[model samples]
Target: MSDDANGRRPSIRDVARLANVSYQTVSRVLNDHPSVRPETRDRVNQVMAELNYRPNQAARALVTSRSQTIGILAASSSMYGPASSIAAIEAAARLRGYWVSTANIDASDPGSIPEGLAHLRAQSIEGLVVIAPQVRVVRALAAQALDIPYVTLQSTDLDVDHMLSVDQVAGARMATKHLISLGHRGIYHLAGPQDWIEAEARMRGFLEELGASDVPTTAPILGDWTADFGYYAGRELLRVRDFTAVFSSNDQMALGFIHAARDEGLDVPRDLSVIGFDDIPEAAHFWPPLTTVRQDFAELGRRCVELLLGPADGLESPSPSTIAPELIVRGSTAPAA
Candidate 1:
């Protein structure tokens, strides 16, 4: 028995000898394996509690075929949705006793992302989770063949297994319907870039909601997912000055619109009611706060992992899973005046 500089406790081997069990048996009991006999498991557990023993994660991984690692292919962007989704995935993976290897990609370029994904595949990863929402990413994925089971946190026209995403249509509808309910007869929409799936989904939802409303709908004002685009678009929108409310595709554009409104001397929620999607961290802190849809991104991560690792849910015409968006009522919204 090796003694510490200040010897006070016995080691795992000592516990194994005292319990009359193999070191492997002791390890299994510590891991909470169901196969261990009840009395032996309890006795080993009691001894471990007394000795304060812990298993090394690296050692455990060597024995199990699972490396306890998950690979994440994420887009590096200032957009709130992608950033929040990565954070959630990391947190959930850590909680499940798995380590994560992330490959940050540029969503605008498909080649760069595929190169990074190729590197991840070389690591012999058990599973892959991709946070791909852009069209370029989709195009790249469509061109490739995957050897391992994986999941995508995206909304695509093509059908695939293990997909988790917020119902963009639902969120758009919620935003527009909220504005319409506030007596805003003329509602303008500031949509995201046309190429993105999220932008298309939001636009579809907005059109559907407006079509359902008794009031007439106006054509959308196009903008990129940036405050600068919104600023420019907002400035142009001021020329018309007919709408009472505006629904922005995302928070960044909404912020830009708010700035533009201020420059034009229009008070938010008073002169012009505005609604935005993705209730980002700073949304509540923005001037007069922002009334937006809260998309649960972390939950998306957990569900994606579960589906990918879960029993064969079967790919024979699998139904799409839709997570509803939450409508957050904040200071930036009010009845149309």
Candidate 2:
């Protein structure tokens, strides 16, 4: 039986005719209806496979009113943290047999938030994951009054019940404490953009640690979370060279800062100790490998899916809501000279 005997793609009716079963029977099999006999279901499935029949997901969704899809509302998605979280959520959603729909919006524009939500809601997503890392974005999302189960990846304290995040403040504190333990009092912080919630939390952690240790605080230099900014900041900051160590918000900036340091004839961890966040793939390969903080992005993704859809079968219950960040000590940091 050819799929295009009449010059049209094969339909469920084609499978039914070839398997000698009713179209209703094929529909039951497609839905895993238990009333269909095992032998009959097997035959229909075999015919479907033979004819390369694929059910129209949109049509099925219309009939059942369940799209089996999740939506991601993202802003600043090009950055490493948001980008990684989105990828993780997609991978986890796929494992659970759900399709993912993403709607990217401008974090700076409040109007784009509702527009993005409306676009995803039209697809009938069963759940939503909000990857808005900015404070204003989260606040804008809250005003929309979304009805579906939703999880926000950033910890803004705006929606504690719906937030899942790595403890950014604690992670920053860990990085700061590591430098302090090494006897470095003259430390400077390279923070992400001021609007980012993670950046704010990290800066808070750094400040809190400095206060606890009685180390005089220096205002953090805000950057756009790029190596280019890090390079320029490094060049300007190094002109005075008052600080003995620097803690960057992310690894890319750390890499750039290191480059600038080298350009100025400063050896990393010898002239200045450096540490970064995210421990990006290239962190380990930097000239003197980057000592940085690591967030379990994969685990974070799995948890986001589980939170919105519940735990997967045969798997343990979801771990704690806040994933702890790990400090990976490497060659970039050392005791201040």
Candidate 3:
């Protein structure tokens, strides 16, 4: 039994001795080398079972030239996009037999993204995935030297080797077009920060829908994609007194809009119609229940991994892709008042 300085006991040597085999034989069995006979493997397995031998992670990494780890640099917390995307990537990576280590970055700061990337590279990470949904992050990636195999989530920039995003434009179109179909002519939008790629795409989709239809377009109200911003924007909606239906950039903003509508003594779906994007879990439980566009962030993560591992021959073909958001019709949206 080899006890480390910390007094942990029972190393591979102890297992080999107990199994009546040389340490080299035990190494072969542990490393899945084919030289070991099945009977010897069975005996080693019995010894390992009895002694509870575990290999050191660092030693294994050195031998195989692989860390068996993936690095993820992501925003600490902004909304469902960053948080949900990280969770999805972690889960999918684990399923592929890789461990995930994450570094949190400030969503608004370009420097934070690269700083996190530096930390990950220092760890000798084999691959890097960035969950940067904002424009700052996009620009940071373009300017930095990301030499490792890299993938970006929630950004549409094809300049990167691999990229994936929820079809934000399509989602916005779904949200706005849905409102238009409900007979509302005066529709308003609470857009997310202009610096975020998703926000820009969503805003574009909303405007394109209005432009394509007979209904007129009002400038989208800017919001920061927070419940408070939504709430405050909701309050502003009361003063405008012109638009009958409002489409918010995300569910958090939608929640604020809902609260603002309630506080202003207006009935949902009766006096005003409201819809949102992201279709968050709580969206269905709002006062009148929300009708919004639902995006599959988990699917997006899986797709990112696939794209990162995809064949590199098709460099010029349609590499850019989009995942469309599904519209969930709920009680919050109704025929215009």
Clashes of each: 0, 0, 1
Q: Rank order by lDDT, top first?
A: 2, 3, 1
Q: Summarize candidate 3's per-residue lDDT along 1-337 as a digit string, tens digits.
A: 3454678877767888889997667766775555579999999988887766666653466788887778888864457878888788777777667778888888767656656665565455778887777777677778876777777776465354567678888889889989989899999999988877888889999999999996797999888889999888878778878989999999888888888999999989899998988888898898788999999988876666555544334453335377777999999899997
lDDT leader: 2
lDDT of 1 by residue, 1-337 (tens): 3344688455657779878897657755654444579999989877766666544433355578566777888874446787787778778777777677888888877666656565565344678888777777877876666677777777766545566688999999999999999999888899987777888889988999999986687888778789998888888988888888889999889999999999999999899988889998899999979999999887777676666555234344333387888999998889988
Q: 1 or 2, which is superior by lDDT? A: 2
In the predicted model 3, the residue pairs found to clash are: 231-256
My TM-score estimates for the predictions, one after another, are: 0.76, 0.81, 0.78
Clashing residue pairs for model 1: none
What is candidate 2's lDDT per residue for 151-248, written digit by digit as tens? 98986789998889999999999999999999999999999999999999999999999999999999999998999999999999999999999999
Quality of model 2 by C-alpha lDDT: 0.89
Candidate 3 stretches with Cα past 4 Å from truth are: 1-60, 76-78, 158-161, 309-320
Q: Which sequence of candidate numbers ranks them by TM-score, best first?
A: 2, 3, 1
- lDDT, candidates in the order shown: 0.78, 0.89, 0.79
For model 1, what is the error of residue 78's alpha carbon versus the real structure, in angstroms, after optimal superposition?
A: 3.8
- When 1 and 2 are scored with TM-score, the better candidate is 2
